[model samples]
Target: MPQFSLYEEEYHPSPLKRTWIEFRNSHIAVVGLVVLAGLLLFSLFAPFLAPYDPLAQNIDGLLIPPSWTVNGSISHLFGTDALGRDVFSRIIYGCRVTLGSSILLVLLAMLIGVTIGTVAGVMQGVRSSVINHLLDALMAIPTLLIAIIIVAIVGTGLVNSMWAITLALIPQFIHHTRSFVRAEMKKEYILASRLDGATNRQLFFNSILPNMIEMLVVQGTLALSIAVIDISALGFLNLGAQPPLPELGAILADGLDVAYLAPWNVALPGLTIFVMVLAINIVGDGLRSALRKRLVR
Candidate 1:
């Protein structure tokens, strides 16, 4: 018989570690993680990585093709735009602005949404139904359209667009969180916790929130992709980051005017946005799968 010792340690991994291990098991998830990480690192180190100031114009380099193209120079790898700004550098800086702002916007949305949702869930009555009705009405419109309307009212600029996107996104988060919390509240554990003298706050913080966190995390990840797209869309429409901002959407918009002369300007920024959204969705799907599997176990 194996002897059990009081000092014997068990190698129990944390939930986060377990979730990561599960996430790593998927090939597509790993690929997504790598791509997302690379983009994030590139954005984080943009100041150091970018070869030139994104806003600086080089009159001599206007509309230069990619470096490998005929008449292209090695100095400007992705070539120059109509304004003679380095396409590569602008793209690098654009990633920073786009991704950084989107993530923050999503987080802010999640915080406000979750708090309101939890309150509604705990106080299920006419108030909860009213909140749900409000969310349904808001969510009926497309998120981008809602954002556009908000931006139109608040006026343009990156910061205003971000706020608009945050407001647009909050409805979805609130809807999902309220549903999740309400469902979780119906479980036996919640009843037991209540019987044991757990207050609403204690129940949420100690039990309900923990069980629902995985879903919230996956929801937030998905919302982040939406935020990125909406931000870029606003920028493309001239309602987001303005002149010299090097926002991906703005760069793409700028490229369109001179696309016939400098195709790389349009292509690179569009491609970057596509890749960023694809990677984010892949990671979000992976998280959902991993968390669901863990819950089943």
Candidate 2:
């Protein structure tokens, strides 16, 4: 009889592989992932994908309708804006601005918030107490209000507006991370680690942090949806991306002026924002469900 190797006798898939298998089974999640990927790819390659320069003006071709319309031309499929800039090109380029800025803002906020929250959760006494109280106070103020105040202090611009939004989002991450860490601390693994002579730093870095990864990923996705909305709102108010930049919010704001004669100007950008936010949310929900199933297993 042939001897079987131990590895072959007791084969098991890695957690990541298992989680991916489970995630792939969800139809909505799969669709959302596809849409999100398409958007990201389009944004990343906008320069090559766009037919015309988004900023170039054709004064004579201004306010043309979409190509499907009788007066529209194939050269400008989505039509031209008030300044005769290609609407399709601007929309394509705007994806980069909107997604890139929001992603950067989320990352910055996550780094600051997770660091502070983890420390507060692990180290007891006045420090933790103070951090919690500070987060509570910050949370009480509306996110938009906080963003507005920060924008005012930093002065107006696209980069500054992102900074403002990042500041406003930090408290949310801190709160969520703190709560997750505190809950994890009460679990049996933490006590087992302590009894096994594991140092506090070792336990946190090796054990606690690894388990928190899934929760953090879920929270990050959810936060992204909120970031998208806030960034657009700021842009609409003229506190974010400035003129001639082709930002979605700025595009929508400009469209408002010519909405009567060229409704596509307002409709297209507004619809884009709506679809982007919806796709993000659907993915977030699907991730939460998939991760929850993994935890249960």
Candidate 3:
């Protein structure tokens, strides 16, 4: 036999690994990741990082401006609200209330939506059509409107509003997942798997579910952004988090009262929500692009 040099075989990263690598290559995505991480960290360590208690009143420091302002003090970096509570401290704690609750809401919605959607897609009969039609009808109504209606019926409160938001979000998830599953089912590979005598359950769990991961990740990010907005809106309307909770939307509502005297109060909380939603959208777009490239490969 002719002498041949032996070398290790080339290695290929998995689709998920490749998608992550691609996501990292996008500079905008990296910036979004950094900003989002910082917010999460700030919220996670708010107990230690907050200079003062979010709800602790300081009658003496009422309406104080930010430290940079002429009338401001270093003790309260972002200054005090009308109630004399530290603005910065309230914001830090608010992150947990706003973002944290949105995350849980999205997850619950996703679980219920994915389960029902998968079943609807696999069935592919009158039953499936009925389910899809129901979802379509629900989706026709704006999610915010649906949420508001639900809250009206359920009564105003943070937990109730979260549940209302979750219900509103479910239709969207079901519609997207159902479409994805149906499309995958029609592919040639799926047909081949059927010809090979694979069970419907096996085809779904093994073949279809694996391929749907990328799409689901994108959808989840989009849902998370929506969740944050909806939760904030409800809080602002007094249907979500209540007083003393340090929720961002509630803070904004309070800011409106003293906006003329201390504009930073409104501006800061509004800016925080804007930045958070922007970062989420950027990360979602990056994921979509990365996953699209992965599919093309």
Total clashing pairs in model 1? 0
- Residue 1 error for model 2, in Å? 16
User: How would you encode candidate 2's per-residue C-alpha lDDT over 1-297 as one tens digit per residue?
Assistant: 998776756657798887887888899888999988888987999999999999999989999899999999998989999999999999999988998888888999999998888888887899888898999999999777888899989887899988998999999999988998899889998999899999878987999889878877888888888888878888899998899888999999999999999999999999989988988988888888887888788
Ranking by TM-score: 1, 3, 2
Candidate 2, after superposition: displacement of residue 262 in Å? 0.5
lDDT by residue (1-297, candidate 3, tens digit) is 976869867989987799999999999998998999998998789999998889999898899999999988998899889999999999999998899998899999999998888888888779988998899899999888999999999899899999999999999888988998899889999999999999978988999888877778899999999999998898898888889789999999989999998999999998999999999999999999998887788
User: Candidate 1 lDDT, tens digit per residue, 3-56?
Assistant: 989897889778888888889999999899899999999899999999999999
Regarding lDDT, does 1 or 3 come out ahead? 1
Query: What are the Cα lDDT values of the candidates?
Result: 0.92, 0.89, 0.91
For model 3, the local distance difference test gives 0.91
Superposed model 2: Cα runs more than 4 Å off: 1-11
Off by over 4 Å in 1: 1-12
Please state the error at residue 289 of candidate 2 in Å.
0.3
